[model samples]
Each structure stands twice: as structure tokens, then as C-alpha cells.
Target: MSKILIISAVFAPEPVVSAKLSEDIANELALDYQVVVIAPKPTRPFGFDLQKDENNQTIYRLQNLDSYVFPESKLLGRLKESYSFGLACKKYISQNRKNIDLIYMNSWPIFSQYLIVKTAQKYKIKVVTHVQDVYPESLSNKIPRLSFILRFVFLPIDKFVLKNSFKIIAISNKMKTYLAKTRTLSESKIEVVQNWQNEASFTSYKQKENQDRRIFTYMYLGNIGPVAGVDLIIEAFAQASIPKSKLIIAGSGSKKEELKTFVVKSKIVNVEFLEVPDGKVPEIQGSADVMLLPIKKGAASSSIPSKLPAYMFSKKPIIGSLDIDSATAKVIVESNCGWVVEAENVAELANKMKLSFKSTKGSLLEKGENGFEYAMKNLSKKNNLSQVTNIIKNALL
Candidate 1:
């Protein structure tokens, strides 16, 4: 059997994007491969809890590993955590090197890839790096001084790993291009494989009671991260003219406090924020009249938010505030399932919100139907799994 070792920062039970992607890929690969994951045990972002791993079997079998303090917490903590993760991964690889064929890992906890590469070298194993989000540059670009440090410290190492890898998977074309220019990666080394959603599970559902009382329920579901343009949504939603329309922003992240501050200062009576249980996304998201997907103006447009397929499957009209070149924008335009707003144009976003609230539900529903059809045809997880397996097979051969 082909033996593959997967390393990631998150896995099942966490409900984060990295976890979902890792779990899905491993599960799919298990059909014809022996997959063992090595993932950092889950912990509260602030606290250090080691006991959480003892309670969950699903998380344990899938390769549970020690959790180190997050880097952003402190300089020493970051260095210690990076070293510990690298060492822990090295120790694990030492024990199982003979059984594994290839090492695969995602980008966040950027240093984890270091372990994968080091261990791969020790065992003469192949390596594949998954670029979930544009990294080093992403972290550094958001903080300019760090840009200099990351360009020197992180970017070169990232490029080295990618160059040595047998294949580097990019989530979007733009990501592929950017990585190529930044890293000077060989054109043949990069592969574009857009993340697919579990469409079967995203099927349209019956609208729940009280769904009609709200003028238009505009929802922004998923992580409230800096790159997602949640601040833009908040600013635009705060000044939106649709007094009866309600904007429900769900999920939590580093930006939650800032959002709360905006809500308090703007006194946007029509907007509400909720700490949504990860499992409750379907019900919460499905209740919305429209789903919002916004990307920050200057952020990498290569990413198509994981929420798009869910929005499509939810059968809700989407309002994407992204550049025309973004994968999300292209999908929305081609599917004719939603409207696109300029990334930084708050006025345009507000107008879209007003227009969306006033638009006929039938036309919106029709657009959603078209989107669902397009998704069904092009973005099924099953199809994606097949494609991924093919890539792995080709790489291995």
C-alpha cells in the first residue's frame, strides 16, 4: 500500500479550514493508501491545554501531536514552539520513516514544513507542500517592518522548500503565479488545484420559521480574518440604507474585538454579531437571504474563500466584494449567481447591499440555482479527490 504521512496544524473537531482540508484529503486517500496524520492537538488560542487530546478518539487516530505555544504570542515563545514542532516531527519521522512514502503538509505554522522537509531528507521521502494561504508575504505584507524580516528570514526558506519539493499545490492561479515570481519556482513545479466543497452536503434546505420576517438577512459566515475584508463589510453595512435589512456576522477571529468596537461606535442597529458554533454553520448560514464574500482590496486575490461552495450549495445569492481577476469574482460572474463589488469601494458595497435587499427573491433564487448547477458540475469534492489522487499517483510514479 502507498504510505503517506500528513502534517498539519489542525484536524477534525477543530472545524477550521486547515483541519477540514487535511481530514478530507486523508479520508479520501485512505480508500487506496495508508494515511497517518500528525497534527498539533487543539487548544484555546490563549491557553495551554494538553488534556484535550485525551478525550477525542477521532482526533487521536488521525495523528495527534503536541501543541506548542503560538508564535505571535511572544518572540521566545515563537522560537521555542518552532523548534519543538520541528523536533517533535523529526522524532515521529525517525520512528516511522521506513513505512512512509511521501510527506505532505499545509503552510500555516509555516515552520512545520521545515520538519516535513528535514524528515523527508532523512528518509529519502518525497514532499508536497500545500499553499492554503499565501504565506510569509501574507504575514509580512500586513506588517511592513516584518516584511523586511520575513523577506530575509521566511521567504527564502519557503522558496527553498518549494523548490526541493516534488510538487507544490496552489489553491488558485494567482497564487501559482505569485509564488513563481517570488520564489523563482520552476513553472513546471507548481500545480493549481482549487479547493472543492462537499456539495452533496451543501444541498438547498427548507427555509426555517421566521425567515421571512427579516427584510433581508445579509450574512457573513466563516473566519473573521483581516484578509476576508470583514472590516469593509462592517463599515459598509454600518452606513447601508436598508434600515430593515439585517447583517449577521458569524464566526470569530483576531478581528472580532475590532468589529465589536465598530458596532458600538457606529451604533449600527441593523447589524448583529454572533459567536457561531462551528457545527451550526449550515443552519445559521442557510437562514440568510444573502451570503457575503468580501476580499480586502490589496490582499492576494488568488484565494477563493472556502465559503463560496457552501454559499452556492446553500442556494443563496452571493455578493462578492473582490477584484474581477479573483477566482471568486470569476466564479460569481460566470455562474451569474451574484453581484461583484470593488474590493475597497464601501459605497459600492452599500449600494449592492441595498439593491440585494430590494431585489426580487425569485431572480435571486434563480441565480442561486444557476450557481448550484455550476458547482455541481465543476466543484464536487468527489471529483476533486479523484484529481488529487491522480496527482499523487503521478508524483509517486
Candidate 2:
């Protein structure tokens, strides 16, 4: 069997959404290909170093300057981590260039991809790039004032990777479209492979009959960051007049403390914060009467939240606060799984929350079922992973 090297910034034992997905792909490919994974040492929220050897693959963890806890607000720390991983990856590929048959990479720590791809090109190795988000553009969205300079400096490098890669995989069609148009690449070069949920692990929870109709729970699960609009959720929840309803914000991010501070300063009584253990995600999600999906207006165009799949699996109706034309809103609307309002509109979001609070359990359950069916039909792991494997095989040919 040919040897395959997978490079990802995050992997198993890291408490991030992409880690699980990356782990699944590496393990699956190991059944046919001689697989090796090069990732950072276990750090951040979930920190447990793994044995180097696994069933059909070998994992190599490189030491880096990244903190045990993610430093979301520190640009210098992030750059140090990215560059460290990049240098390590470059050295590994340089020494093992001859043995590797194909290079598979995740698009993150942009510096790492630039280094690895450049090195791979020299070795004449075929590369398949999996794009989780469109960079420079995604970064630009967050910092509009710096966008022009960012595009000037980073766009060329982005184009080089796109133009030189054997194949490019995007997690969503919206992402593919954005990349193709911005990079001026052919649509045919990019393929869409939606993320899949582990149905076995994320089995839906049993619904409990509401003993107290007066107290409804609205929950948001996933990162609490500017892009995620946790503050928007708080602001809207605070403004809403749902006397018997409560809002629960679960998960951690760079903005988690900032959000908590805001809640305390504003004297918001209805909202509660919870630290969700990874194993308990399904349970927490299922327990909610409705799920809150909020995204900043600027970020909606380039990326879809990773939590969408889990939320779908939870079989809970979504109250999506996103741009009307965003890919996320499109999914919620098309699946008929939930309601949508314009992002960042405090009044509108508050109104939606109140409406969901008043909705009957039957109506919410029906919507949740619609979402679950959509997930099974279109986002099944078997189908999506088959697409990925087929692409890899074809690239090898």
C-alpha cells in the first residue's frame, strides 16, 4: 500500500470540533493506506498526550509554544504556534519526501499549509487540500479595515496553494463558491464534502414531559466568540420578555469571559453559563426546548458553524440568527428545521426567542424531526467519507 501523510493543526485529544473529524478521516484511510499523522502535542482545553502508535497508523506530535489553554486574544502566541508547527512539518516532509505517496492537509495555521505545500511541490508529490474555511477572506471579514492589505499580502499565497494543489475539498458549497471566485480558480477543481456527525456517539436523548410549562429552556452550544455572536445572544435574551424562559450558553472560547462579564454587568438574570464536557454534548443539546444558532453578519458568507451537525442530531428546533442569504440560514430554511432572523438585529432576535418560548412542544418536535431526516439523507458519514476516499483514489490515479 502507498503511504499517506495527513497534516492537521488539531487532532484527537484536542477538544475542538475539527479534531474529531480529522481523527475519523485518518483512521478510515488507514484501512487502505499506510497512514501517518503529524499534529501538535495535546494542548488547550483537552490535554492528554496519546501513544505514538495506533491500530493502523503512527502519530507524530511535535512540541510547540502553544499554551495548554487556547489564547484566543493573543496574536503573538498564535503566530508562534503556527510557525513552530510549520517548521516542524517542513522538516518532516523534507526527510520523508521519497516515502510519501500523497499529502493530505487541513487548511489551518495558514503558515503551515504554505510551508508544507511548498515543500510537497519540490518533491513532486500530489496534494489534496481540505478547506474548512476560506482564509484571508475569513480573516478579512473579522477585520474589515485591514482587509485590503491582508488581501494584497495573503491572496497571492492563497492562490498559489489553490492553483498548485491536485484537488481541493471545501466543507460547504458556500465556502467553495467564495474560494473559486476570490482565487479565480475553476469550480471543477473544488468539491463540496459536508461534515458528518457520528450518529452512534451522538444518539438523540429522550425528551421529558415538561412538568412546569412556565419554565422553557433555550440553549446555545459551541464556541463563544465574536463570530459566534454570543454577545448577540445575551443582548437579545436580556431584551426579551419571556418571564418563564431561561437561556443557557454552553462551551468556551476567547470571548467566554467577556460574555460572562457582560451578563454580570448588565444584571441579566435569565441567562446561565455552563461548561459542557465533550461526552455530555448530546445530552445537553437534547435537553433544550430550542437551540440558538447565532452568527455575526460578516462571518456568515464564508463559513458554516461546526456545531450545526450536532444540533441537527440533537433533534431540537433551531432559532437561527444569521444573515438572510447566508449558507447557514439557507440550510435551516431549506430543511424546514427552524426559523431565521437577520443577524445582529437585537429586537428581531429577542422577538424570535419569545415566539419560540411560546411554541407548542409538538411544533418544535416536528421541526427537529425534519432536521434529523435532512441530516441522515444528505450528511451521512458513509456518503461524505466515500466521496473523500473516491477523490483521494482518483488523485492517486
Candidate 3:
């Protein structure tokens, strides 16, 4: 069997979206190809040691400043970590060039993806680039003052990599359209392979007949970052007039403490913050009366959150605060799984929350079932895995 080297900035044990997806990809490919994963050591809030699985696939974890659970969130520290991982990955590929037949990578830590893709091209190895999130676009949105300069410098580099790769896999059609328009690449060169969640991992927890109907729980699970619109969620929850409803913020990130402080200072009594216990995500999701999926307005065009599938699998209606035209909003609307409100509009969000709380259990269950059926039919793990593996096989041929 030919060898396939997979590179990602994060991997299993990290509790990040990229990590889970990358781990699943490696395991799936291992059954047909010799697979090796190159990643940085697992760190924070889920610090798991480097591990190698029984399939004999090797995992090479390089040293970086992210040795601790929460590294300094400075720009320089992030660059150092990215460059270090890039250098380590390049060295490994250089030494093992003759043994590797294909390179599979995600768009993360931009420098690492650039280094590995450039190196693979030089060595005449086949490469499949998975476009998880649009880079300079995401970067530009975050720093408006430097947007022009960042795009000027990085767009060409991004074009070069995408142009030379054997195939570009976009996680969403919106992403593919963005790349095609901005990078001037052929739409045919990019294929859509939406992310999938393991349905089995999210078995629905049936509520008891006597379960409390007095309190409605609205849950938000995932990173608490700027782009996540978490502050908006908190503000809306605080303003909503649902006295019997509770908002659960279960996850960690740079803004976790800031958010907690905000709640304390504002005396927001209806919202609660909790750490998600390992292996309890499904149960937690199932217990909620409604799920909150919020994204900042500007970021809606380039990426879709990896949490959507899991949310759907939990069989609960969603209250999505996102760009009305965003792919995320499109999914929620098309599936008829939930309601959508303008992102960042605190008043609108508050009204939506109140509406969800007043919704009958039967109505919520119907919407949740719609989402679950959509997920099972279109975002099934088995289908997505097979699709990705076939794309890799075709690229190798």
C-alpha cells in the first residue's frame, strides 16, 4: 500500500473541530493506505499526551510554545508556534520523501500548510488540500486596518498552493465559491465535501414523562471566541423575559473568563457557565430544549462551524444567530430545523429566545426531527468518509 502523510495543526485529544475531523480521516484512510499524522503536542483545556493507534499509524508531535493548556494569546507566540511546526513537518517530509506517495492537509496555521504544500510540490508528490476556513479573509475581517496589506501579501501565495494541488476539497460550497472568485481558480478544481459528525456518538437521550417542563434550557457548546458571537448570546439571554429559562454556556476559550466576568458584573442571573465533561457532549446536547448557534455577522461567508452536525444529531431545535445569507443560516433554514435571527442584533436574539421558550414541546420535536433526518441522509459519517477517500484515491491515480 502507498503511504499518505496527513498534516493538521490540531489532532485528537485536543477537543477542537480540526482535531476530531483529522483523527477520523486518519483512521478511515488507515484501512486502505499506510497513514502517518504530523501534529503539535496536544494542549489545553484537553491536554492529552501524544498517542499512536493500533493500526500502526505513527503520530509525530513536535514541540511548540503551546506546551501548556493555555498559551499566551499574543500574535508573536502564535507565529512562533506555527513556524516551529512548519519547520518540523518540512524536515520530516524531507527525510521520508521517498516513502510517501500522497500528502493530505488542512488549511490551518497558514504557514504550516504553505510549507508542507510547497515542499510536496517540489518533491513531485500528490497533494490534496482541504479548505476548512478561508485564511486571509478570516484574518482580514479580524483586523480591518491591515486587511489590504494582508490580502495583498497572502492571496497570491494562497492561489499558488491551490493552483498546484492535485485537488482542493472545500468543506462548503460557499468556501468553494469564495476561493474561485478571489483566487481566480477553476470551480472544477475544487470539490465540496461537507464535514460529518459520527451519529452514533450522539445518541438521543429520551426525556422522562415527568421531566420538568417549567424550565427550558438553551445550550451553547463550543469555543467562546469573538467570532462565536458568545457575548451576543449572553446579552440576549440576560435581556429575554423568560424567567423560567436558563442559558448554558459549556466550553472554554480566551474569552471564557471575560464572559464570566461580564455575567458577574452585569448580574445576569439566567445564564450559567459550565465545563463540558468528557464523553458527555451528546447527553448535554440532548438535554437542552433548544441549541444556540451564533456566528459574528462578517464571518458567515467563509466558514461553517463543525458543531452543526452534532447539534442536529442531538434532535433539538436550534436558534441560529447568523448572517441571513450565510451557508450556516442556509443549512438551518433548508433543513427546517430551527429559527434564524440577524447576528449581533441583541433585541432580535432576545425575542427569538423568548419565542423558543414559549414553543410547545411537540413543535420543537418536529423541527429537531427534521434536522436529524437531514443530517442522517446528507451528513452521515460513512458517506463523507467514503467520498473523501475516493477523492484521495483519484488524486493518487
Per-candidate TM-scores read 0.89, 0.91, 0.92
RMSD of each: 3.2, 3.1, 3.1
Model 1 per-residue lDDT tens digits across residues 1-397: 8788888766666656666778787877777778888876564232212233355444214766675746233445655676677777888889989888987777344576776686787678888788877767666646777778877887767776787788888888888988899889886888888788776556545547445765678899877767678888878887785767788988766677788888888777778887766456667877788899988765656777778887887888999998878778989999999999888799999899888887887888898898888878766786766776667767777
Candidate 1 displacement at residue 113 in angstroms: 1.3
Question: TM-score of predicted model 3?
Answer: 0.92
- Residue pairs with colliding backbones in model 1 are none
Q: Residue 51 lDDT in model 2? A: 38
Every candidate's lDDT: 0.75, 0.78, 0.79
Candidate 2 lDDT, tens digit per residue, 106-136?
Answer: 8354677788889899999999998877777
Order of quality (TM-score): 3, 2, 1
Give me the overall lDDT of model 1: 0.75
Query: Where does candidate 2 clash, by residue pair?
Result: none
